[model samples]
Target: MLKYQQIALEIEKHIEENELQQGDKLPVLETLMAQFNVSKSTITKSLDLLEKKGVVFQVRGSGIFVRRHKRRGYVSLLSNQGFKKDLKDFHVTSKVIEMDVRKPTQEAADNLNIGLHDDVYFIKRVRYVNGQTLCLEESFYNKSIITYLNNEIVSESIFHYIKEALGLKVGFSDMYLHVDKLNQEEAAYLGLKEGAPKLTVETIFHLTNGQPFDFSKVTYNYEQSQFFIQANNELL
Candidate 1:
């Protein structure tokens, strides 16, 4: 990781470890520079990164402060940490509906940049947060890249396994968000009526080497789902 990005994560970790509330002021830039043993420009870059992520905001005269988020629920769209890590404060659990190695579907093949004849790990799961059904996810992992998977890993966090166990570096993802009505199967899994509106996110996750490893579609219960994203103004 880049130095600024590392510092940005460290600041975020500090906020979480200290249980800093929204609007709580972080230490001044001088203090941060002294603490992190970096120069002013580096600290500024780190803060700018955090600001773009909606973690903190700067004031003309006041110090940087934590940004308030939705009180009910939130999911960081920019983060690849998976639900288990992102919402560590909540009870996040996964029920593996199905898991098997299968030939890649056309969509999966294209998204994962694998051949149609390639075998992939097909996984279906329902994720719950605080005992409430949040989303149903269907994913395909390129077997060549992922190598191995099992029931235990699927029931907890595949990303965790891919990172810690497999020792792979996750890079970024391309995501598309849309609103759709639930189908019968999705409705049944979420305990919602058929045709209920839901938020659907389709993503292709790539590794640091720029190889697409996973393709997934996640349908979230609209009433319980809130998504957050932070973008740099330069991207505009």
Candidate 2:
């Protein structure tokens, strides 16, 4: 008796081993049945699981193909955590360019709770996952706390250091998202053209004590990114 779970596991194993890419079709029902000795019902269940998990997509009349990987960075209320509940799930990398530390303007001072005359640490970075450019992030932090940011800080997730090293685990945040055209500087880092479609996110992360920790603006190239939001009835 071939169970659906067994079929699903086999399919999972196949995906990891094969360079099956988006648009690459998997073995059809007959091929799967012949090799796995599974019934049509079980195979159907397996395919359904893959579709729901975003691993495969079904085209009308065209059998299933590997689902193109999408990097979904939206609804990231706690991206301080990671992409998929596990830290490794995020898998994104970054290249940081340190910006000059200077007196913050009125807008910067207000956002980061600093005085207009106070110095602020500004860093720019392009974020990637799986070797693909996904985001361009400009971050501002209170220079009084963060004297400077270097390459080491840029390559890794900033939340990791703030929480584990500096003990600045954020307890809350406010985020707004929108679509916009990429400006010249932003387009350059992200390998996008000026006026390219991009996702813009303005985020304010707060410390557990209700103090602002950081303010950042992140722009994502839609072609290289995908977003996720899970709904739990109980949580709602």
- List per-prediction Cα lDDT, in the order shown: 0.89, 0.73
lDDT of 2 at 136: 81
Relative to the true structure, candidate 1 has a C-alpha RMSD (angstroms) of 2.8
Q: Which parts of model 1 are misplaced by more than 4 Å? A: 1-7, 17-25, 39-45, 57-65
lDDT (Cα, tens digit) per residue for candidate 2, span 1-236: 24876778778778867757778888888898888887898788888777765667777787988864444344343355644342245566777766667777676678778788888778788777767787888888877766556678657766777766776557788888898788898888888899989889888777777777578888987786666653333346
Q: Which candidate achieves the best lDDT against the true structure?
A: 1
> Per-residue CA lDDT of candidate 1, range 1-236, in tens?
79999999999988978878889999999999999999999999999989888889898797899875645446788777776655778998889999999999898999999899999999999999999999999999999999999999888778889999999999888999899799999999998999999899999999999999999999998877777765555676
- Those runs of model 2 whose alpha carbons end farther than 4 Å from true positions after fitting are 1-77, 82-91, 231-236
Measured with C-alpha atoms, the lDDT of residue 172 in candidate 2 is 80
